[model samples]
Target: MKALILKRYGSLQNVMFEDISKPVIAPDEILVEIHAAGLNPIDYMIPKGIFKPILKFNMPATLGSDLAGVVVEVGSKVTRFKAGDKVFASIFDLGKGSLAEYAAVPEFAAALKPDNLSFAEAASVPMVGLTSWQALVVRAQTRAGHKVFIPAGSGGIGTFAIQLAQRLGATVGTTTSTSNMEWVRTLGADEVVDYKKQNFEDVMQGYDTVLGTVRGDALEKALRILKPKSKIVSLIGPPDGAFASRRGMNLLMRIVFSLLSRRIIRLAKQQDTHYSFLFVQPNGEHLAIIGSMLESGQIRPVIDRIFSFENAKLGLEYLETGRAKGKVVIELKDTTI
Candidate 1:
């Protein structure tokens, strides 16, 4: 099987194709024949060694996290799925990747693909869906009458977050280019900020929650938009101490993260707002619920482009450009190496 694998960290140029043996599953895993994969910002970051300290990988690691595939074999401990089941999963932080012809999926991370979606669409849901579900529903506790600000409203996380917030009855506010203002509004954003013409902090106020999708000063600026006792869930982060403690990092690393996030922490504290960083975790049950939402048309996959598996490098290149309006997918089954 040909797979795009990292030859070394520190550069995307190190990622290349190689024919390797198919993965052998453990008793608690399923062997999936991948048909499609979704590319995220993290996919490119991995090869750049951004997550090296925490997400350690063996040499030549496969380079993707999200995938939709058919199960060729199931583990003895897996009861929810059988051979030939169509499944989608985010195998992130799992020490393996999905950008290969085959992957070994743990039972806990595998969910049946929604009947209403194509393989590429199903592949696009897991990471973004999980991130939004955790940020808005689990962490922020967004509810009816609450106003939630989600930046990058037309991006992968933004598109899903807006719809999910609306489903939870929260009024949504988001930032997008002028062209995508109406696009995000249709995704359920009640307030749209044109980041070009106006700074959101200047115009949007009294929000109950802010899903911090953009990096740098955006999270701190978000503090201005929220009311006292509100929450900001940062997806892009100089990760906070809470995240460090949850991941069980060493004291040295925990201190490093603390120092990294101290300014935002103090700024959030000064405003009486709660700020915490989020790392999306994979859960099949959560994906199942999101899959149901996709099937019901409560939310839809926003795909910007689909590249043949042979052109996956181009897919990653395109994603790295940060110009895509939504998720970018790479199809595999009918594509050549």
Candidate 2:
């Protein structure tokens, strides 16, 4: 099967398109014939060695996380799906990814794709969808009447997060460029701050939760807007000891993360708010819930563009520009075996 393999950690030049043996499934896994793969920042960052310390992958690793496809085979212990099942999953285990003709996914991390979506649209959901679900519903415990602020409302995660927060009954506020303000409003953000024309911190305040996806002073600004005892969930930077412990990092790594997040953590405390980093994990059950939401039209996918499988490198380059309004996908021509 043809797959995108990284020979070494570096730039796009390290990504090689070549034939590789199809992965065999474990007892609790399923082999999926990938029809489409969603591109995320982590896909490029991994090959750039940005996450090397935390996520160690062998050379010649595949570089995708979200995928929608058909199940060609199921492991002996698999129960939720079988051959010919249409499914989507976020392969959270690094290195073992879906940017290929086929991928082996843990059964518990795969879910039936929504009937309303195409393979490309479904592929775009898993990573960003689950990130929003876990951060808002699971971590922040968002509820009706709560004020939720999400920065970068036009980006992959932000697009999904805004809708999900609104669905959960929170009043959503988000940041986007002036050109995207009206567009993101369609996603149900109650307040849209044009980052070019206005600062989010000045316009939105007293939030119950803030979902921070950007690096730099965005997290600092997010902290200032929260009401006392509010929570700020950051997807980028300054991962704290709690996150390190959750990932079961070594003592050395834990110490490193603790020291790294000390200042931000202290600042959050001083403002009478809590700050924690979120690393989205794979969970089939959560995907199932998201699938239902999609099926019922409670949430919709926003796709920026779809690239052919052969031009995946160009797709990654497009994603790196940080100009995309939503998820970028790579569509495969042959999914049937």
Candidate 3:
């Protein structure tokens, strides 16, 4: 099988196409004939040695987090799906091998693709879609009539967050550049703040939840927008317990988190708010729920571009620019064929 392998962690130049042995299925896994894979920032970041503390990987590893394809073979212990089943999955584990022509994914992390979407579209959903779902529904417990503010609303996760929040009857607000304001509105954001022209902190208020996608100082800004007792969920690691817990740092991190949380608790006393660091886990059940939403036309993927399999490195470069409006897909074979 052909795969894009990283010989060493660095830039796009490190990614090379090579023939590699196809993955053999584990008892709880299924071998999928990958049709398309989604490119995420993590794909590029991981090889640069950013996530080294959390994920230990061997060199020549394939890098891709999401996949959409047909199941070719099922492990003996896999009862959830069988051969010929079309599936979509968040393959964040198992060596991130979705960039290959085939991949073996745990049965629990793979869901049947929605009837309404194409393979490429299905590929785009697992990571960002699940991130939005987990942060809003699972962590924040966002409810109808609640107010949610999502930063980077025109980006991958933001696009899904805006649509899902709106579908659940939440009043959604988001920040993006002026060029993306109308696009964010189309995704169901009730109020779109042009980040380039105005300060969202000045005019936005009373948000029940603020979903953070950008890191560093932007994350701190998100914490301030939430109403008293409201929650803030961020994907970016750093600050607080989530990053420490994820890194498997020592108990010192626990003590640090305890002290930092006390300060946040004090702030909440003044404004009545809460905060959490959300790291989305792989859940096939959650993917199924998203599939239903797609089939019902309640939500749709926002795709910025589709590159040929040979051009996956190019897709990585595109994502690195931080300018893509939505998901970027890499098709293994031309569907028109």
- Which regions in candidate 2 have their CA more than 4 angstroms from the true location? 334-337
Locate the minimum summed-lDDT window of 10 residues in model 1.
328-337
lDDT of each: 0.91, 0.91, 0.85
In model 2, the Cα lDDT at residue 11 comes to: 82
> Which scores better on TM-score, 2 or 3?
2
Quote each prediction's TM-score.
Answer: 0.98, 0.98, 0.93
Whole-model lDDT for model 1 versus the true structure? Answer: 0.91
Q: What is the lDDT for 329 in model 1?
A: 93
Worst 10 residues of 3 by lDDT: 260-269
Residue 267 in model 1: shift from native, Å? 1.1
Model 1 spans with C-alpha error above 4 angstroms? 334-337
In the range 258-281, model 3's lDDT, one tens digit per residue, is: 575565545555666766666667
lDDT of candidate 2 over 1-337, digit per residue (tens): 9999989987888998989999988999999999999999988888888888878788788889999999999999999998999999999664597889999999989999998899999999999999999999999999999999999999999999999999999999999998889998999999999999888888788899988798998898887789999998989878899989998999999999999999889999999999899999999999999999999999999999999999998999899999888999999954232
Task: Name the runs in model 3 displaced over 4 angstroms.
Answer: 242-249, 252-270, 335-337
